[model samples]
Target: MNINKYTKTDLYKIANNLLWTWDFEVRELFKKIDSEKWETTVNNPIKLLDEIDETEVVKLFNDNDFLSLFEKVNHKLDDYLKNKSWYAKNLNTEKDLKIAYFSAEFGLTECIRIYSGGLGVLSGDHLKSASDLGLPLVGVGLLYSNGYFQQKLDKDGWQNEFYIIEDFNKLPIELQLDENKKPIIVKIKIADEIISIQVWKLIIGRIELYLLDTDIKPNSKKNREITETLYGGDIETRI
Candidate 1:
């Protein structure tokens, strides 16, 4: 990724190919995702792109499944970064330094929810901006089965909240096993109830981020879905 000459399309294509490579792995990793998961999640890249663009990134997300996976729009930030020339200017910042940033939403692009909206996309852009400048920041967020909800305007221009659950175990987001072949699991206490958040680590270019999900067992029925609704609901989901 030569930042200097890379257009927005180039970056989008790079991301699209990375995802397509992962599509090959899902077939072998989780042998039996519900047929809907298989078709809806794993088998639909263009659909995901359109979904994100429609709901999050760009407002008009009228993209079709067969459309080019290239990001033809939004060179605004790129132009600014080039003008800043921060990547080349900040040599000292790249000297083995590290920074960690946490956020609830990450719409990486309209094409990828891993980064969601201004907050999330801004988070993603920050990550991108950092990378371009070779800055040391690790963006952190949950590897949600579905990261965020998308609200759309109807003909009436009112809003609707649409839930999109991702099959993280099968997509660009996945877990890495330790030498002992175990997926990392971390436990936390919320409102005096024991909640376990399974950690799924994802490699984002040069950065590494661990995502937490409470949608697994070993948790009480109450805790099993604690993370389902982000930023809302009581943490006292005790059984």
Candidate 2:
């Protein structure tokens, strides 16, 4: 199916944003499209959209009940974004001020497993809170290709580790583009080598979270894996 046709619609806009992660009504609308696909995709709307065929998409958009709920959720998101909060009213003088939050991992949602434990959860919550309060805040973190490990037990009662590779295209993230439509790249020096990095942006309500990635072609394989695992590398890799 040609998913590009619906890219300009409100459904695509709502699905692309992380706001649906916290909103039950918005999630329900996605579930209404295909409940089995929704569950299989782990509540990831982007993946759900890709999996549905044209017939399913047509039936869904043509349903009156579905459209009603869709409009309600869309309006809720619009109002939430437009409404001012305490930060706006009290910190009007600090309009030029912006905060950058840095963390090794962020547990924004289950589908995006860039986080591992408690610290990551706390950092994710901080971003969400800041967004809700209308604070001019942005989050910075590394994009892990492996994103921690999935643990399983063997017959001998021992633990085993397996890493799952993430496809960024299926996730609700957008690659940062420059004015010329090229990817915006950042270069940093580590010892004698200069590592090239690309940025991915994830929307958290009104706030934006920028994730740094080093999996570009300009870097060596070793350097490309620098952002591979979350807290799974040696001291050298950690550095």
Candidate 3:
């Protein structure tokens, strides 16, 4: 099993594939449908009365828009595959052992909102790469009620903050559900004290991530609300 960081060549190849002149061919039906939708957005903001007829829909193909959308989708798929491979390489050894991967980062591949920097992206890569390789690794992470804040500093040392919100349920992830189909909760010893934790499950495309929280009913308000802020807080806290 090969395991290492993605090299410059890998990066360049990805870029080249993205920039290639040849695009995925769009089916006539899809082209027609997409064109009609584009026309509706460009011309009719209110979508009054189905302005474009079926016949007109067929003629509405905007080649550039179609190509752009196709490329973006392909890029996303490519990224997922690459990340899946990384995960497979790192943790797929014990086939029969039920394994769960806990990480706080889990970048855009899991949720667009958790991107604090390269760390989340790296964690996402691990999850994706593991999934792609069919590694028996299940991902566990945190979903923010509020997205991570990335601080950017200017030359004058002024800090600028930006937020990325995460919708975990939308991301590809699975959960150990109770009989009611809700995420299963667990009890742990934190600081020599018993604490209960509730988990939230998310689906990140084809990836699976579970988020941990201590805000469940059984826990007291003194339990610190745990969620992804800079992305690694969960793993760090748990460890």
- Model 3's C-alpha root-mean-square deviation from the true structure amounts to 12.6
Better of 2 and 3 by lDDT: 2
Residue 32, model 1: Cα distance from true site in angstroms: 29
lDDT of all predictions, in order shown?
A: 0.50, 0.87, 0.50
Candidate 2 clash figure, as a count: 0
Clash totals for all candidate models = 6, 0, 19
Using alpha carbons, what is the TM-score of model 3? 0.49
Q: Residue 107 deviation, candidate 2, in Å? A: 0.3
Residues 1-239, candidate 3, lDDT per residue (tens digit)?
22233332332233222111112331222333345653443322113113445443333323455345544544665665456454356766666875588766666422246556687778777765555565666677765656667579999999998765443343333346899987688898877767777776554334456677665566655554455354435554546
TM-score of each: 0.54, 0.92, 0.49
Ranking by TM-score: 2, 1, 3
Model 3 worst lDDT run, 10 consecutive residues? 14-23
